[model samples]
Target: MGTKGQLVTDPRAAALASKAWPYEEARKLLKRYPEGKPARNGQPAPIIFETGYGPSGLPHIGTFNEVLRTTMVRHAFQAMSDAPTRLIEFSDDMDGLRKVPDNVPNQAMLTEHLGKPLSRIPDPFGKFESFAAHNNAMLRDFLDRFGFDYEFISSASQYEAGVFDDALKGVLRHYDAIMGVMLPTLRKERAATYSPILPISPKTGIVLQVPVEVVDADLGTIRFTDSDGEVLTQSVLGGQAKLQWKVDWAMRWVALGVDYEMYGKDLIDSGVQSGKIARVLGGRPPEALIYEMFLDENGEKISKSKGNGLTLEQWLDYGTQESLAFFAYREPKKAKQLHIGVIPRAVDEYFQFRGNYAAQPLEQKLGNPAHHIHNGAVPAANPPVTFGLLLNLVGVLGAGATPAQVRGYLANYVDGEITPELDALIDHALAYNRDFVAPTLVRRKPQGVEVAALERLDRELAPLPAETSAVDLQNIVYAIGNDGGFENLRDWFGALYETLLGSSQGPRMGSFIALYGIDNSRKLIAEALAR
Candidate 1:
């Protein structure tokens, strides 16, 4: 790792450190901590990079994107600076459960716990101590699965342990200023009842949003009216109270000295409000990157409560984790539609970038998404076959094609023995084809000139040897299409795909024939003509 005032020696790392988005983020950190550490109370402290999670529901793709992107930036910073750093995967387990999500089970049981902190509610799954603990474990499991290096901190644990005591005091001291920053953002009704602190009700155990009657900054206590119309005073420290989310965000920045964080574009206004509160609390808000949000297939914003977007598990079922990372790494500022239909393209593009990494020049290699996805440890070789080709192979081979049969046919095109990567790709292709492709396939019977052309093409292929090259077979098909009185050759190819493959779009006819065998192609043509 390069130290302060030390030049980056490796050309590729230097190029990437200067060009990649992660490195661009890293540069901001370098500016934040010029001497390799931030000064805290006249003592040097390790720089903190934090990602927040709301354990109100299961960890979704949005959670993964934040941590993954943050990790990328952390890695880039590590490469460019010798400063020690900490990545805190913070979970807001103390957050109130506003309502039941559409996805989880035991809805009635969860609904009963509404308005309580997630950590105080019983787990619906019955596997953990509380609902928040269950979701927190899930968050750690997936992050560990991705091999992310970080520390997990729960909000309930931190607050109950008095880790936020000093910060809580700071919040009490700046209560009026924080309220001044927050009130203008809320509607009249909400602003009327809003307080910087939400006291957990002593009798009902619900987080309350009542009006504060008195504030004692000196004693770290506040007097508020309970839902029963009783006046109560409680210390705001420890687990007695939690700040409103926007104020809590600022308090967290003050408590942890967070140096850098990123949020969705939708939170741009909230971020500004939190920054103002942070300033009021005598702390600087962290530098932030506002990336565009992911949208569902219908272009609606993906929400965890609605469970509208694809989960990490769903994406992993059909594509490699590296492919998903590649998707997250590209043009994060631009909105991208995330759905099952995008998997094949993402998988193919990932392999293409990986395959091209080695031969690329130093600058180009650094610029490639694969380099960052792999942390500069990109594999030397990738599977030669594309994900699209594999899907088409599965489609043409019919529903009963076993894995062994797919491997057997793949041997004809692959020069060397099949690698494990190829085997995994084949499995993904099989599942995707079975679930997504087969149901949508519509085979249309050839009509008009298409019928005669296909017959002529089948007859023309009969004389060709089984071992003919794909190029030669392609030339024969192209010639037949050209001479068969079809004004547009694409129509002939379309007819071949629609009639023979049962899809309007497919792999190269030459390659499909070579893999499926000339006899099989002829039989397919015969069957289509007969139909």
Candidate 2:
């Protein structure tokens, strides 16, 4: 609480503590526990911030979004309050696997394990003890890579270890009350068969979904008919049974005393239903931030099982992790198309925000996405050039552009030696151009006066020394376009981009020539004329 308590004295921190979304979330918690730490059993109870992961499929960008955003809120709370806080990265691994994910291998093996608890199924990947274990390990690895401070809790382990014993009992005691909250929300057919408790079959090891025939609140047991038409009595406690997802969500809130959590907008109804059940169990529901879901390029909701959106690895391939975080920080309530195409913009904006952070005023600095992305420790170094500019450079230089070659051209524009940040940007630009840009390039053949314009611009550039400034070269190009009998200057520049770069859009002509060189521009014009 050293500098944390001093947030009021530091105007920058003070500004952020009042304005930022994370700060707003922090204020909610502050209101919940006004004394900073609520007392339980005469001891200060640590506020719990929870994020849930279902290990049915590999962790995707949506998974990262929830955890990272939660971490940001957790950091905000730590910066403004002296109360101890704990982040629970809860894995719902004990839940049954309903279907095989399209992204995973060995689908035939996975099909055999349908309806069984994920932790009990054999790992199709053949790496970990079970499928859920493999996914849970991957989730941990990614979160660890980001240096997230949190405790990983497995639902299977929590149940088997009796960590949720009392909570399970509470569910049994309030079974009818919990069902009262959920039944009306389901379809008539589903409502007739729905039960809050799902008992894991001792014989088949599958989670049974049949309706509960009886509930014994005193004995903590449930009676249900099996698929075999035999009635079985199962203890609601221990790992023998688990509640339905909505009910389970509430049980966790009561058991762990979760103070704050965030969910996608799609889960609004579930959150509402769960809150009702939590109240029935005599527990207050956590404060929630409902964020919009990410969509694929087709505008369909991104699914982890379908694997339709950008994966974490795919995004990191073309952008820095900070860029991804920046993307998450912006407009959390607004839907965004999460795809490979969006990476370049996100990267450039991250660089722009980071570069401007130190020079920004106290209030602006606090409001900048870079401030929260880096957790108030924004890096001093910025990329020498934007990712968009670098992509254009790569396109003009072609696929043969090596890192050193790109750096040599960049040296002409950037004043200092290439920092590692710039160096990484160069690599990402090259990779993006090779994969996405190069395949789509189609140089338009010069028609009529377009040929004359290219020739005149080529000649105008021929006299300019390599030392000539981009501005001067730009002026020369502008004069050529103006005198070339083109009705509009935009058409002239469009001709230049399409004829020379094989793309409809390009960097500034002067900057492109400076980087691509005057001789190369001449050669490009010559090639276009020949076509």
Candidate 3:
């Protein structure tokens, strides 16, 4: 039988609980461990927060996601408590180079380097000292640009310096126990020769996956035969050996005193295995928040191997960095499709979050994504025109329009002077339309049943008053499509978009037409009919 029910009420926690679920979750954790570590002078230790990346390929959007999301929760945690926090952005550069990415240059040069540690591989781009350094530099540049407060740790350097020597020894000492935890998850065949450690061959310096012949825990040594059939014996310390990934993950948590970490849903099984290993090694596992992976437009999980998602550069080229951060802000557990198609919506939502933050109550305001997106310093309000609207303006104003021409149209539409910030947004919108939209544009004639729908749409637009509201115009467009035998509103809308913008999709037609003016709209319709 259960104990007596208790109705608990804490105003502060309740307030956070009402706004963002993440903050609510953080608040509960803090409340549960009010007297956690390092209470030297009656003050609790700073929360040790960590996120890690495997530098196998160039750091992609997926890499940035963990940092972005972890930082968001860290921000929320700061609001909920006076306890200090530290976010460690660890890079596992010691990982063996499994395969050279197809996108990287000089693939022929990499055949000799396969199975070598990432830090030891030559930078194919010749821009950085090593492949790992290049990717790490790219990651640091991005973090610096975003002003993320974090400490970057390279596993290669840490290993070489013996920072994890003790933990590596512990893994070797408890070899059988670690195997008991890991082998059950592997195929029955793989369990036979698998070892917890992969040693760098003394001859070739490549990480060798050969079967470990012996592990002497008291001696702190492991013996394995290299591919050359040379019997090599190396001390498990001083970077001579590295534990397998899951064991390394667990050991890192124990060694670094990690209190919180976030992982992609794909790592759930690994997290469970690692948690068990951490517990077996007499260390507490860090709390975790697992998020679903991002997918490409095709609904396949976005992967470096698949080359199915936008690179950080592509996203920044098409939209603001804050917009990308906003994309990560919503529903962390829900799978999202990240493609160029989503950029416009993310930008518009960023603006909306910015506008709403000012008027929101204090409790709700702190939880607003814009609060974190701007790092608590939200910019001035933006013009009502959205990225989608600016894009429509680009198409309506015609391709090859200069920045000044776009600004002039935007000024007229929003009825305000375009600020420098807004002007920059316009620049990006035009570039996006040119790169992603313009090339996809087509001027196909309406065929059969669709032809009458276009004629009916033109007839309806001709009679509308110049002062008609966008709402009324939208309703009229809807009515015209239903009457012309194209009952599917989307079909009619597609025809109108292709006719006017040379694409199958554009901004809300009513607002677009209203802003473009009756004269301009009629001229475009006539041009479409002639085509």
Candidate 4:
């Protein structure tokens, strides 16, 4: 692969990168699924994966990220094999409502349907099957726009279509062990926080606890008691439908043929319980990839019920799909502050990889990692635009303005003539708009300039070509950074502000100029100076 300078020259690290760890993880999971079994045909069955788009709120980026991570690996496999790999994105719509999600039209629906199943809600979109359909539609739209390939399997569809009939019967046969394990799972108190889970009948409202024996296999009948001995009712209550999480985890690996699965760090319990279920029920747990949590702009883990998640729709306004893809590929290893701010870096790295990919020749492996992250290859880059202008352009464009409209508004102050180099930039913008909603806010107005430096800037820059080199521009900007009676580094900081951002402090000025077009950079800073 190619790099900004020379190839990395290290064979071992290159080898390590060639088979991305995530892909390996997926392969390991295959061994645990029925598809992993040796066969004459040697063709693997489809892998069924699950995700819950809770109605507690609009599905956010974290929601999409979880699903996308699975899709990413799925793509890796598809790329490598002539064979088919099926992935199913499941919705937990048949479950009951624990709380109301933000932005949903009906708040009263929660109490009105208090004990009713989530699958029974009326469709808000008026076209979908039910309330769950509207919420799922938003998620589906995002997944499709972002290019995720997955089969949509809803709880309503699974039950109504009777996909769980056999599994349900198996669950009844193991009902005793299910109750034996779940009842004590609660009351870990003082040390562990357990929210007492119990299954109840929706029609009877009878708490189905103790010997969760054959509840009505049909006509909706079943109940389970929580730690508080309160009965909870659910229409779809059975081993398969209401399989105590651990057993359910194992069963899916067997039933749907999921080979690989990844979960957040906080879900250790689910992972542990699923491991147990695998041994007892399906006889094997899916391959596990534990991911780290995603923090907000303020470094807080995003929570849907808590109204803290920033949806994928919002992040798209400031970033591209490739940027988002790269972000997912890189993160989930450690917790880092997240916000619209992370987009630029992801975009830059993606472009760097693309540049390298274009210049280098390498073998394509279906199960191999993207490897570009380690190959020192430069990714395709979206030509640089002024950050301020980008923010503004996206600001208006993000508000559902068409690309043509965005182009018209951008033409007003983007004084320089358009260049073919920026075609990539336009494409990135289009993808961002087509994928996500506008962010609630942009990065703190990219980190403020000095009047003395500003005054010198106009003259300093006047001699340059309308389209100048970023480095050349930055060099000129810093050459005079020590102006205006300055004696120390602090004094020169103003120059960085003037040339790079029209502020006294900002990103590394040279790096900033290199990424942002010189002309647009000048225009933005000049306007800021005029203020």
Candidate 5:
């Protein structure tokens, strides 16, 4: 637990900060999964990094975090050496549609198509070919906007193309071994009759979970009792069958020659199971990076099902993609609380890191987060104004203000002319204010004690020189709050935020008021007090 500016330099932090870390790790993985290894089975081998998507719901910020973080590592790997690398974004759309998502349309229709493969189910939105196709397209659209260069492979297409046929045969041949690994994890009843290969019902084309009568691995087929109690045999190839989730994960690593992959902390046990299955199938498992989950402000796990986590769209509305990327850039294994309120601070921190990255030596630069955020091609500098400051300006200016209007206001606050970057920030700030701030504005008049406190604050500010630093004004605000009978600074800050920004929290009052100007601050506070 280290705070900013605190010298809590540990050996682990030092090692991660070292320039040689990425290069050494890349070279090590190259050696571990060498080009001419037996695992490739005479196929051309590329250093593969895989990420899986479950298209049960719309892709959220968490999904973006996984892809962006993995891409950062991939970019680092490329910076290390010229060994060809590929990022495979896999979609598990062939899995059965056990339950319909509550967010989508046409719920009654989805209920009728339950138990079918997600790819086979009709799209609830009625715009795409299938439900899986719609979600996969959404995933592609977002990733493409980010300029990500990667291969997208869907499980439905892979199964139809017989890409996993060899893996399936291997699983069937060693069914007993896989069950030995999986059975212990299941309850007694489930362990009694669990099959690694779940064959789709030949009659209805629905994925079946019935008992397997026989595994004729020699013929590359399985006889399974379907939902209707009719026994049937299907070739475990070309979309006839799909391995269980854990088994599919392990098999994908071997079949695709994936050298590296990462997963959430909740999948730690599942990763172990997959690793065991991979080793059992005579393939070296991919190196793993298990990241802790992102929680909401309330400390509950962020999930698409729970709809508690902030979506990627919401963050982008308030901040840049780079800021969101920076949030995922550091200490991935540590639990991070992400919400709409933290956007401006994250944007500011990114600018701070960008400054550090630009000034640091090449050796020292590799350890900085901006290095990874920009994929080692960091910009020379950031905009002059902090996002929080710009946001505060937006709060006061009202969301309806035009970019030209903002440019006019900023011309006086900042020393130099408003550059193109500042112009862009103004646009983002106005959008952020409209989406997150303006609608929450408090418009009631302050009475009695609140009125007196505002007047006192306004009187104190009325005589201050325009050149007064933000720090000095901050002290004055604190004293006014204490003199106004607030228990502590936190409560006073809360009151100020509620009366001023119409939010429970906001940017530092001193910097905000200072940038807003002395006379303007007094007038604004007076307006609120007398509303």
Candidate 6:
């Protein structure tokens, strides 16, 4: 078991723990390969694969998630390892473009490039080589911005050149047996109307199977040729692809030289196949780490190209990148809800992970300078403020708040980057939108003080110290509480809440006074009472 943000010590804990993250997922991976069995000399390399989707449109959050999961697992191995390792993000741009996303305003521009591999799609914006190239390039940029290391291999390039020839042959060699298992299982489990491998035409909704034969299967690949014996395409050779997805998967574990891989429970039958294939094909299958599917909070899988999908880029533009990272990761074999509304809790969790742990392998990977700065290795010389503050600042500045806007309104003199803090606060404020009927949700009331408590606060402010600071303000709140009236002097609670929250139940009143400056504190209270 592990604490929140702690390295998981057991696999079952992956499914049981609250606030699950990368650690539990890592522990689950470890369980697949016991501590000392088949004791090899050193750590085996993990064969990590992100089934890169055809990126004909802007990539959605889930695609990023596929790679992100791989990245997280990669880090776990790195964190657990004594040396460096690598992971790859393979894109199936060779696959035909599926559909146009709503976010992209120009639908017509994408129509001409439908049947070809996404990489060959012409860039509508005329910025990249092709449509697939344009979308994937942006997505890759987005991923790289977050510090993911991926060696990208385009299926367009691979297939056209017959890179998987041997693997395709293997698939042909075992095609009948492979279909024997998959066809029945899929029919019984899912009401799937289509085969796992489609033979449909892109232009029309019709199935067509011309014909192809295995030309070769060697050098870790499978090659395909037309019935006329003209080389057509190639994949990793061997009945490898035919080994039932599970068996094929097991074969992947061996052929790809993968040490760890995770999938959804929806693929359980395939997982069963991977195990069978591992035994049939010799050696061990890669770790079978399963994660739950993510549905919108309302309960539907987030779909790409439907405009209904939540994207990582969209999430990051609004919330911090780290916030997106923490939320994207999870463990278990069920469905989890991920939507914009959960941003705050996710942000809060990320911060807590940073403040409470040594960051590396806990909060983030070590040696990332930006992550260090973000976590506050650079001491905060000024008083702390929330992200809500910065967001507000952005709004204000847009409406013409300047550095000098500092003294114009809400004017009090405490140091720090006021504008930035204001922006953070405003951004933080929008998080409550989850509870709203519209896109924008504002915090209702400032965190409340009682009339008597207000008076007490007033009286405390009378005898001002030469050096009023947060501590001094706190003392005043405490003093008022210590000497009070009636049934328990609600002044204490008010002071507590009002002090930190500005209405009380927050920081010490004295400290609040000091941190926010006496003027701002007094002004805020007065305005609150007036309202």
TM-score of 4: 0.70
What are the runs in model 1 whose C-alpha is more than 4 Å off?
Answer: 1-9, 39-44, 105-108, 213-215, 304-308, 447-456, 478-489
Better of 3 and 5 by TM-score: 3
Question: Which 10-residue window of candidate 5 scores lowest in summed lDDT?
Answer: 8-17
Best prediction by lDDT: 1
For candidate 1, lDDT tens digit of each residue in 1-531?
A: 345856556864674456778888888887876666756687667778999999987777888899999988888777777677899999999998998977778889999989999999999889999999999999999899889999999999988888988888888888778788888888999999898888999998899988774467766788998889889999877898898898899999988889899999999998999999999888889987899999999999987657688988888889988899999999888999999989999999999899999877665666689988988899998887788889988997777778999998888777899999889988889888998998888778999999999999899889988888888999988998998888799989999989998987887788888877888889999999998
- What residue runs in model 5 are displaced by over 4 Å at the alpha carbon? 1-44, 213-215, 398-404, 415-420, 434-514, 525-531
lDDT per model vs. reference:
0.87, 0.86, 0.80, 0.55, 0.80, 0.50
Cα lDDT tens digits for candidate 6, 240-302: 122223443454455555555666667776677666555444446656467777888788876
**TM-score, each model?**
0.92, 0.91, 0.85, 0.70, 0.83, 0.66
Candidate 1 vs candidate 6, lDDT winner: 1
Model 4 vs truth, CA RMSD: 7.5
TM-score of 5: 0.83
lDDT of 3 at 486: 70
User: Mind giving the per-residue lDDT tens digits that candidate 4 earns over 219-310?
Assistant: 44445554465564444434223443456555556566565677889888878766665555545566667888988888888776576655
The top-ranked prediction according to TM-score is: 1
Worst 10 residues of 4 by lDDT: 189-198
Task: Evaluate candidate 3 by giving its C-alpha RMSD to the native, one decimal.
Answer: 4.9
Task: State how far residue 239 of model 3 sits from its true place (Å).
Answer: 1.0
Models ranked on lDDT = 1, 2, 5, 3, 4, 6
Error of 1 at 307 (Å): 5.1
Worst 10 residues of 3 by lDDT: 1-10
